[model samples]
Target: MRDWWRDLTDLVLPAECGGCGRPRTVLCARCRAALGGTGPCRVRPAPEPAGLPPVHAAARYADEVRATLLAHKERGALALSGPLGEALSGAVRAGLATVRAPGAGGGSVLLVPVPSARRAVRARGHDPVRRIAYAAAGELRRAGVPAHVLPALRQRRDVADQSELDARQRLANLAGALTVAPGCGRLLSAGRVVLVDDLMTTGASLAEAARAVRARSWADSPVRGAGSSISGPASVYGGETRERRGEQRNGPAQQWAGRRSGRPPVTAGADSADGVVDGMCAAVVAASPDAFEISRN
Candidate 1:
């Protein structure tokens, strides 16, 4: 009922720019340019996390971009999903270009979003990341790329709020909080999986998610009902699994180790059969973080 009323109200409300509150438009032209310009760029938190995948951000988390994202995410400015998805699609494309090798087989690309806690979803009345991922997939398909969203990742343990933590603290707090959904290993193994998130700060959340996904082992031979094969070291703090396997194999473990040591992580695209490209892709509509900040003056 609340959702229905909100939708009806939005339909009747006077137009206003979501970024700067300009009248007569949902997203004004100037703001739209600010949000979408410059193409996608690589972004790394000041202090990167361990084992984090290479990450690409469409825009810096500041200015008009920040405003637009917050408006859509926190205030339920649902109409902005189109532009946001478009922005994210660019990031996905950029991220894919970074990791894919020349002539690699392009299989289907699976976008696995980092799940929000139930409490957060209940408070917001929606799951923002999942919604954005769906929108992003649509954008990808329109560009002749086959993509799908898999909501098969979830928090396996409770975690404290992350708003106040530094990179290291954030890592410790989120270390074992994620797990693949039941029966999701096969889905992950079926194609390349790219972890997607709306915003990344410390990157602890994404790193932990990658770790959890990597840790779950896939049975060498397919099993009828073995329930996903679960092997590998479990974290002492949380009993979450940590290793994974499939018909497709990972690059030498050393390759990941060196990559992890060098810089913040970003998605790497994989090549598909018939010369289709697959790998991790990320996209965002805006890059400015300051746009969302409230001015005191």
Candidate 2:
């Protein structure tokens, strides 16, 4: 009922620009341009965190882009999810195109979001990244892309707040801190896995999220209830061939049909059969400026 009221109230109230607090506008034209004026492009963090998948960001995190994300994430400006999500959707498309094989149909994409710490979520009143991912997934599906929001990873242990941590320290702090929710490996192997986040800094969180996806290579085969042969985007890296990769894709997961009943706040992705998760990609609404400079080389 609370969610219903929130929805109805938003319909009746005059919305404000989430980016600049402009009255009677959800997002001013200037703010919308900041979402992805140049469109989505590849980005790479320096000293790229290990296991970090190839990533694309819709816009560079600067000026209006930075301010927009701050307003939405820290100030609970829920309406900004629309524009921000459209940017992320564009980035997801670019990321898929970067790794797509010739003659491919661009199979369904399962957007797996990096999980937020429970305490931080409580303080923020919502999971910011996950919210954007869901909005992004909705944008893709509306555009005829088979995209679904699957938040499959969770924090395995508590870590200190990242506000003061250096890149190296953040990486170490997040190392071994994420894991796939049990019984979702079959789901992971069923589609192209795209990790989605609202922003990327040191890339540490995404790297750790990738590590959790890799760990699912060891998951027990899917239980009979949710049985379905896997189909996924081929990874060109790690030298894993289609036929060799196909053999391992046939079986994954434990009991997705039975075990996961908690809605989409749970679920996950990545193609890690045969001990290699390739062709994996990451997408974000925006990335740090240094990432753009690094991608050029």
Candidate 3:
């Protein structure tokens, strides 16, 4: 097979860095540092989309970072997944730190990936986002940080190609396009959910994924003998939010709007109950450099 031969030859052939033409290395030191060397930072898209979850990213998607992501995602550079995954794990950890204090023992963090449409998956020959997520989970576990990948979110319907859409049109196209597989609520309740992606441009996709996860009811869903009732969730994010029966709850769209992280607080005593916040938390490996600029709106 063509694919089989390429894999076999790569093992014996001299390799080149995916990001740069550095010889004899899958990724060079310079390129590696470009991935996430300065630690993860919060990134907000210019003219942020509605319903977008607050997200952190490891590095700016430019130069080496941009090339590395494309190589792994589009070129079948499977060897690059390790470094890419490390970048994503840092973003995930930074996002988690926002909701939980450092050194606080708590529920596991679920790494839920946004699923590609079936048609896209077939054309690519691999699911790049999910693959990176799996590697990221492994990186977290190795460092004693509890995490796992769950492809719980999927396309509930087809969507128009996002390439030609503007920010507003992209948001409209992805609205209501995703849903969680039935019976996964119990698993979601066991820990926090952090949506992971390789890259986030307009953030329309992430917002829709969050809606599908939080819009459905979990109390009535069965998971063996385990179940929980956390009241009416107006907004559940990386941290705790409280709501009671008949009370209006602001969703993630409103809740994440006002917060910016200099030093994120881990909200442990914020709630004693064990449950995933109805709102969502999100992170990505890399984002456009301009995304970090704080807007005054």
**Model 1, residue 98: displacement in angstroms?**
2.2
Q: What are the candidates' C-alpha RMSDs?
A: 9.4, 9.8, 8.3
Model 1: per-residue Cα lDDT over 148-180, one tens digit each? 888878898888899887655776787668888
lDDT of 3 by residue, 1-297 (tens): 544564566677887898897999989999999897588887766555444556888988899998999888778777788889999999998777655421235678789998887887777667888989999999999999889888888787899888788766776687668877887765665566788888888777776676556544333445421232212221223232222222233333333422443222122212224522233478899887777655111
Off by over 4 Å in 3: 1-12, 100-105, 217-279, 295-297
Give TM per candidate.
Answer: 0.73, 0.77, 0.76
Candidate 2 regions with alpha-carbon error over 4 angstroms:
1-9, 100-106, 218-278
- Give one digit per residue, the lDDT tens place, for model 2 in 43-127: 8776555446778898888887887898778776677788898999999998776443212554578899998899988777778
Error of 1 at 269 (Å): 11
Model 1 spans with C-alpha error above 4 angstroms: 1-8, 101-105, 217-297
Highest-TM-score candidate: 2
Ranked candidates, highest TM-score first: 2, 3, 1
